[model samples]
Target: MEKNKTIKRAFIASLPVLAGYMVLGIGFGIMMRDKGFGVLWTAAMSLSIFSGTLQYVGVGLLAAPATMIQTAITSLIVNARYMFYSISMVKKYKGTGKYKPFLIFGLTDETYTILSGETPKDANENKYRFLVTTFNHIYWIIGGITGNLLGQIIPFSTRGIDFSMTAIFIASFTEEWIKKNNRKGAIIGVVTTLVCLLLFGEKWFLIPSMLIMTLLLSIKPKREAAK
Candidate 1:
């Protein structure tokens, strides 16, 4: 009974994320299909390169056929920040036993947000968290596979699907902004991103923008604390 309840709660908590993943995953699938990858390729990509934005970019990489060294460098550049996110969770997820692999595998932006914000009062918090993470991952897999299959027959434009990722980022930023009492961090984030984008342009701006944003926001809290 206790385990069943935990599963129920996890399913409910993950419902919203599941919806988002389905929509975005479908977009990615359509893009991959248009690029000439079949179902096997799509499944492999989704399973191995689970990063949505990176996976989308990877479609182009597949078409262009980068060397192993280039693929490694590109993946590292795009996903370097995941190292930082993992650092923050070291203590929260310590001693997770078999759950460790899944935790690492499912540590996407949405999963992290949901797990980090979950203040579980129940005794099975770890189990519940794991369930939530696994559920979201399954949603992504399903969505990706469905989209790839559908893309074979459907005649739809994938032109604007790329924008869906940007929309997700905006929505996430807005939610974080609204929840925080301090507006200074939010303002700094916006300013830094804009400056970096102007300097670097859309082609090569993300890493630098994130680094500047992190540095700027890192000091704001200390300043607030010192006051």
Candidate 2:
């Protein structure tokens, strides 16, 4: 009975992810097809990499003659945010046993926000997290394959499709703002991101923003405590 309840809660939590992933995953699929890749390739990437923007960038890389070092640098630059995310999640996922590996692998932006906003209270905490992680992964895979299939038959413009990922992040931030404490942290992230964009432009802003935010937060404790 309790397990059933946890499943229901997890399903509810994953619905938004389902919506976001379906749209963005479809966009990725369409983009991949434009590069002459097909459904199986999309499935493989989605299953193995499971990164949204990185996968998109990686498609271009794959088409080119980029070396291993080049690929590594690009992935590191693109996924710098996860460095901060891993710091906090390390404690929470400490006792997760076998689920730890999968949980860490599947920790996307949306999942991180949801998990960060709240820990399990009444239910089995690890189990709840496992369900949430597993469900979201399944949703992503479904969306990727669905898009791959649809992109084959549909001719469409991918303009503004990338916005779906941004929208999902915004929605997650909003949820954190409304329900979670530490609004200052969220404000700092926004301010740093905007400043980075203005200074660096869109193509070069992400890494700078993440770096500054992590640095600011790292120094926050002693300084704030001194106050």
Candidate 3:
């Protein structure tokens, strides 16, 4: 009974993610199909890699004759933000036992937000977290498969479809901006990103900006505590 209740609650919590993933996954699928990749490829990528932004970027990588070393470097740079956030999640996930590995594997931006958000009193927290993770994964897979199928028959342009990933990031940023009482981090991120863009240009700004943002955000909280 308790397990069932936990599953239901987790599913409910993941509903918003369901809506977002379905759309983004479909967009990714369409893009992949447009690139001459089949539904099986789309399903395989989504099932295995499961990083939305990376997968979106990966379609281009797949089309190009990029070397394995080049792909590895690009992936590291693109997913570097995970390294920062994953540090914080370490404590919260400490005692998750058998669920720890999958929980870690499934830790996407959305899953991180849900797991870190709130927990119910008396609920089996690990179970809840696992269910949420699993549900979100299934959602993405279904969406990817569905979109690939749709793309095959629907004669539509996939141009600009990749923008869906950026759209999700923008929406998430906007939401965080609204909810947080401390706006310094957001301000720092925006300013640093713009400055880096101008200085480093579009192709090279991301890494430098992220490094600066991480440094500043990390320093601010400690200095405040000292005061």
For all predictions, the C-alpha RMSD in Å is 3.5, 2.8, 3.7
Q: What residue runs in model 3 are displaced by over 4 Å at the alpha carbon? A: 152-206, 220-227
Give the number of colliding residue pairs in candidate 2.
Answer: 0
Candidate lDDT values, in order: 0.78, 0.80, 0.83
Candidate 1 residue 195 Cα shift, in angstroms, is 2.9
Name the better of 1 and 3 by TM-score.
1
* Top candidate when judged by lDDT against the true structure: 3
Candidate order, TM-score descending? 2, 1, 3
Worst 10 residues of 1 by lDDT: 157-166
lDDT per residue for candidate 3 within 1-227, as digits (tens), equals 88888888898878778877877888888899888898899999999988898999899999995789989998997787677668869999999999998998888988887686666654689999999999999989988888888845646665565455556557667777788835787799899999999999987788788889888878858776685
TM-score of each: 0.79, 0.87, 0.78
After TM-score superposition, what is the CA distance of residue 3 in candidate 1 from its true location, in Å?
2.0
| Residue-level lDDT for 63 in candidate 2 | 77
Between prediction 2 and prediction 3, which has the larger lDDT? Answer: 3
Following a full C-alpha superposition, what root-mean-square deviation does model 3 have from the true structure? 3.7
